[model samples]
Target: MDEISLLEQGVSFVLHIDQHLFALVAEYGAWLYAFLFLIVFCETGLVVTPFLPGDSLLFAAGTVAGAGHLSYPLCMAVLLGAAVLGDAVNYEIGRHVGPSIFSRETRFLNKQHLLKAHAFYERHGGKAIILARFIPIVRTFAPFVAGIALMSPVKFLSFNITGAILWVAGLVSAGYFLGNIPVVKNNFSVVIYGIIIVSVLPVVIEFIRANLKK
Candidate 1:
């Protein structure tokens, strides 16, 4: 097996890579936190890449904090900033790129999706961006979709701020609290596994419903 492919190794493999750099991440904890945040931000912010492990990573990081390796408050702060900044950047990208989507020659991009995002924007309006924080892949796609539809910038920011705070605070706190349980402490991997499964449920349900309706 190859030693360094995300495909071959999966999340555990990636965490091993994170562990290798744990010492360095710990040395400049804030920077490390920000670095992880950016990745999460980009993953959520970019429509092309909505598969990042925002939930699992946050939970695992919180668990790490519970063990005294990382500071919980700092971890929360960094991840929150990452979550918020990610949305903001993604919103800007959408705002700028929306018109280009109008061109006929755009490859692999669908105008219908932009329309759909707009529809979603209308139904849920701004809160979708913020509420989307709880769901895994959707959180990433929401902003991009919103931007593609040219959602109002001020409205996006309002929900984005609310969602960022709630999203980050909720997940971090979940880990901090549950992670300290005796069973959870001993079975961190099990907990993380469950988190991953739960995180993906929203996407799965939507996928199934979409197919079923057709």
Candidate 2:
């Protein structure tokens, strides 16, 4: 598909994730797992794809699994790995790009700034990485920034694995256990919009607070 077509489809998927997921389950059947895996991976991995569905997708997948169309345990495993590996890859990319930007001063960028960022990330990377996993868009950029700041791989991995487990298991299990409720099932799109808002609420609050401080 062309870029515009892809963008339109992506937007449609995000807005109607539950309906699209149901259609996917109907059409792709077993192959839906791979699609889910890719969505989770890209949403978590690529900075450009922060717009892709994460929380809602997981919940919808869990709902499908709960309905017996998919396997819950397997889905959890697949997504957990995708989440972790995606962050890892993003970190590596940032790590590689960071040095070049820092090796020399630009008209606008300075080595001292990068040094301060590195120091800040070193001190707070662990908690930030774990917490960021729950917040949309922030989760996508947190690890990349950590890498740009050169957070320790060992420390990053520990928190990355822990956060991925909690994020995938917690949301998916919520859907598995609760998604079938008549009210949630009937209002799945509303629930999805609510999830997206809640996921980004922290970022929104922080932005508002920063603006007020200024």
Query: lDDT of all predictions, in order shown?
Result: 0.70, 0.80
Per-residue lDDT tens digits for candidate 1, residues 117-196, read 55556667678787678776567667877776777888888888888888777777877777678887677667766766
- Tell me the tens digit of each residue's lDDT in model 2 across 66-132: 8888899998988898999999997887788755765676664334434533443465657878888
Best by lDDT: 2
**Per-residue lDDT value at 25 in model 1:** 63
Looking at candidate 1, the ten consecutive residues that score lowest on lDDT are 13-22
Residue 147 accuracy (lDDT) in model 2 = 82
What TM value does model 1 have? 0.78
TM-score of each: 0.78, 0.84
RMSD of each: 3.6, 4.6
